[model samples]
Target: MKKNTYLLPILRTAYESLTKSEKRIADCISADVTTFIGMGIAEIADRTDSSEITVNRFCKKLGFAGLQALKLALASVPSEEVISEEGFAKEDSYQHIAEKIFQNIQNGLADTLSLLDYDAVEEAVEALLAARRIVVFGVGNSATICQDFETRFLRFGSIVEAYSDVHQQATVASLLSAEDVVVAISHSGATREVLDTTAIGKAAGATVISITSRMGSPLAKLSDIVLIGMGREVRYRSEATASRLVHMAIIDILYTGIALRRKDYAANIAKMRTVIRVRKQ
Candidate 1:
C-alpha cells in the first residue's frame, strides 16, 4: 500500500496508546522529524534510550514495515504542510470560532483518511451489497448516524433498518441470518448497548462492520471489518461530537461505493425522485 502523507497526524492519533519507551521514540521523532529521518534504527533506539527491537515494534504499531520504511514515508511528507490541531479559545470572536471549527474538521478528515484502510472499506461495501438484510445499531449521538445510514441506503432499494433502542436492536439481531449484515456505530467503541446488540447479531451468524475511533475497542474486536476514524478533542467540545463528522464521512464513502456497484442505482434514485415530486406538487 502507498504510504500516507500525514505522518504527524497519524503519530498524534496513536500517541495515547504507546508504551513509555515507545512514547519516548515517538516524542523524539515528532519533536524533530527532519533530523530523526536521517537516523537509523540503532541511532533512534540510542537517542530514545531504548532497544532496536522496541524501535521495530514501535514502527509496526504505526503501520510501517520497519525503520527504513517509516523514514522514507516521513521524508516523503512536504515540510511546509503541517497539521494545526489547535482549538478555539473562549475569547475568540464568532468568525474566528467558525474558521477554527472548519480547520479542525478539515484536519480531522485528513487524519482519518491517513488511518483508513481502503481494502477494509471495499470489503464492507461488498458485504452490504450481498447481504439479505442490513441492520444498523447505534445509541445516543450515534443513533442519528444510524438513522442517516438507514435513510441513505433505503433510497437505493436496500432492505436496511436502524434501531436506537437497545431492546429493538436486540430483537433485530436475534433474527438475523448468515446472509445478513450488521453495522454498529460508536464513537468510543465501548457503548454497552451497541456492543450487546452487535454481539447478538454476530451470534446469529451475521457479518458485522463497525465504524469507530479506537482500533482496539471491543466493538472493533467483534467486527468482521473495522473502519477507524480520528476526532481530536478541543476545550468545551467532546471528542464524540468531533467524531460524528468523521463517522458520517465513512458512511458517505460506503453509501457512494455501494451505490456505484448497484446495477439499479440510477433507476432507484429516479423512482424516489418521482415519488417525492408528487408531494411537492
Candidate 2:
C-alpha cells in the first residue's frame, strides 16, 4: 500500500461522474494531495473554489464519512514513488504484469481490511451458525464466490446452498423463514437480481448479510448486516475483478470464525481426513 493508494484510485474512478464543483475539488487534491491534506475543510473549499458543504459532499461521494475522514486517509498515506506496476502497459514484461496484478490485489486486500468491522463480521458468523438453512445469492463472478461459500460451509454439515440463477434465487428467497440466512455478494451493491432476491429474503424474515463495496447502495440498504470492501478498479480490470479476492477473504474469515465456535469442529475435521484417506485408495 503506497501513499494515497486507495485515494488516487477513487479519484480516478469517480472523476467522470463528479459534479463540476466536485471535479474542481478532486482536481485540486489530485494535483497536490500533500498540500491539500494539510488544509481544513474551509481551506479546501477555498482552494477548490467551492463551498464547505460541497467539499463535504465530495468526500462522501468518494465513500468517506466527511472531509475529516478524507483528510485522515490522506494524512495516513506514506509518500512513496508511484510504480509502473500500478498500471499495465504494452511495453511491460510478463513479470511486470504479474507484479502489477499482485500489487493491485495486495492493495485492495489492505484497503478492505482497513474498513472491516469485526463486530459486524461476528454478527454474520452468528447468523450463519444459527441458520436453519444458508442460501447465498450472487451473479456473474460473484456467483463463483457463492459457490465457494457453499463448498466451505457444507463441510461442517450445514444446510447451505448457493444460487446463481435469478429465478431459483427469487423462489428460494420467497420461501425462507426467520431461521434462514442469506449471504448476498455484489461488487457494486446495486445488481438488480441480487437486490431483488435479497429484498425477498429480507421480507421473508431471514437474516440478510451483504458483502459489497458501496455502503450506500440499495443492496446495503436492504441488508441486516453490511460488510464493506474497498475494491478499486485496475487499468483494464473491472471493479468486480479487484473485489473478488476481497470478498473471498471475508468469506474465509467468516468460515474460520464459525468453524472455531463449533464444538464438533475438530471431530468433523478428523472424520473428513479419514474419509479423504479412504477415498484416495
Candidate 3:
C-alpha cells in the first residue's frame, strides 16, 4: 500500500501516541505492512510486547473497530507495486528503471530504518567484532543472501561459514560458541532448516540474529536480533521478488554499517596488503 492511502494516515497518527513498547509494535507494522495488515491483534501484541488492553487502545486510537476493522482497512489497498508488466530491475529503460529502483530501494531502506532495533544491530555487530567465527545460515533465496553475507564479513577478516544445506548448517551451528554468532536469514521465518539451524546455534550458546519479513514469525521469536523487511510490495501471489530484495538491501546496509565502523582498521589491513602485492610483483 502506498503511503498516501487511508489506513496509512490513521496508523501514523496512532503511532505517535504509542509508548516505547507500543512503538515496537508500530515498527513491526511498518516493516511488513501486508503481514501486519492481515494479522490478528493477538499476534501483533505477542510480537510487540504489548498487552491486549494496550492493543485495543492502540486500535481505538487509530479509529478502527478495534483491530479487525483496522486489518480490513489496511487490506483494502493493493499491497504490491503494480508495475506495468515491467519489473523494477529491467535495464531497457535504464534511467526510468533506475528511478523506480531508487524508489523500491528507498522503501526497503525505510522498512529497515523503521523496524531496526539499533541496540540489537549494535549487539550483533559487537558479537561479530569479537567473534572467532561469523557463521551464516538460510534456506533457498536466504542462502544466496547468506553467501553474500559470508563474502562481506570475510572482507573484514572474519572467518565465515555459509551453508545452504540443512545438514551442513546444523553441523556448523552445533560447533559455535558463545564467542560466535549466527546470522540467519529467512523470508518466511518458517523455513524448517533455518529454524533448525538457528535452534542449534542457540542451544550451542551462540548469539542468533534473524533476518526475515514477519516480526511474529518463529525465527524472530528465537533470534536475539531481528531484521525485518516490510515489503508487501508484491501484492498478488506468493512470488519472491520484492521482499527478498528488501532483505538483501538491509544486509547491504548492515554490511556497510559494519565496514564503516571498522573502516580505519580495514584500511590499515589493505595498506599492509600493498606490501605483499609489491613483493609478489
Candidate 4:
C-alpha cells in the first residue's frame, strides 16, 4: 500500500523553515493531530501561546488559506487512505484499474472542495444572479464545461450563452457591457482563445470570472474574480479530465446557490420538468 499522506506531511517538510513560534504551533498540531482538526484558530493559538497571525501564517506556509482551510484538508485524510489503497499501478487488473480511477476522481473532488473559498463562490453566485446577460467562454475540454454551465443557468430562466469558437467568443465578449458577466473556463488558465475572449470581456467593462488551476496565469490576471479548481493532473489521464470534474462541481455549487436565491426558481424548475415530461410523452 502507498503511504497515506495529506497536510501533516506538508507541515513536516516546512518545519525547519518556520519561526520558533510557528514551530511551536506545528509541534502542537503534530502532537495532537485529532485535536487540531476540531479546535478553532483562537483555541489553537491560545494552546500554543502564539498569536492568531502566527497560526494563519503557519497555514499559508503549507499553501492553505488559513486555519479553517488547514482543518478542512486535515479532515480529508481518512479519504486519502482509500486513495492510497486504490492507487494506479502499471499492469494492474481491469478491476484494479476501475477502482483506481473511481478513487482518484473521489480524491480530486475532495481536494477541490477543501481548497475552495466559500466567499469567492458566493461572490461568483451573486455576480451570475445579478447579470443582465451571462456569457461563458471556453475551448476544448473547458468548452464542454461552459456548455453545461450555460444550460444549467438557462433552466433557471437566465439569459446565458456559451461560446467555444474563438471568433464567436470574441464577438460575444465585445458586445458585453457592465451589466453582463463573463465566466471564463480554462483548466491550464493559459488557453489563448479563452484568454483573448476574457480580455475582450474585461475591456468591454463586463465582470469577468475565471475558473482555472493557476492563480497567476493570464486568465486569472485578467479576471475580476478567480475561482480555482483542482490542479492535480495525472500523467495517464487526458488533459482537463480531472479538472473538468472539479469545474462541474463548481458549476453545481453556483447553480444551487443561485437557484436558492432566486424568487421563483422552484416554480421555474417545476415548469421545466413538466415541459420535458410532456415532450417525451
**Which wins on lDDT, candidate 2 or candidate 4?**
2
* C-alpha-based local distance difference test score of model 1: 0.87
What tens digits encode model 1's per-residue C-alpha lDDT throughout 1-281? 33764677667656766789999998898688899988888898899999999999988988889998898888877787565657667699999988777777776787788788899999999999999999999999999999999999997778999999999999999999999999999987888999999999999999999998876677988999999887765666765566899999999999999888888999989999999999999
lDDT of 3 by residue, 1-281 (tens): 22223454334423434578767866776678787876677788888888877878766655455777667766764666232223544344788856655565565555445555566667667777777888889887777888888876676766887899988888998988998888899877888888988999999999888888765578877998877664534333355455677777777777777777885666756876887699997
Which residue pairs clash within candidate 1? none
User: lDDT score, residue 102, model 2?
Assistant: 78
Per-candidate clashes, comma-separated: 0, 0, 3, 0
In candidate 2, list every pair of residues with a backbone clash: none
- Cα error of candidate 4 at position 111, Å: 1.1
Which one wins by lDDT: 3 or 4?
4
Estimate every model's Cα lDDT from 0 to 1. 0.87, 0.82, 0.71, 0.78
For model 3 the TM-score comes to 0.63
Query: Candidate 1: TM-score?
Result: 0.88
Which scores greater on TM-score, model 1 or model 4? 1
TM-score of 2: 0.83
Off by over 4 Å in 1: 1-5, 40-43, 46-50
lDDT of 4 by residue, 55-75 (tens): 998877667777887887778
What would you estimate as the lDDT of candidate 2?
Answer: 0.82
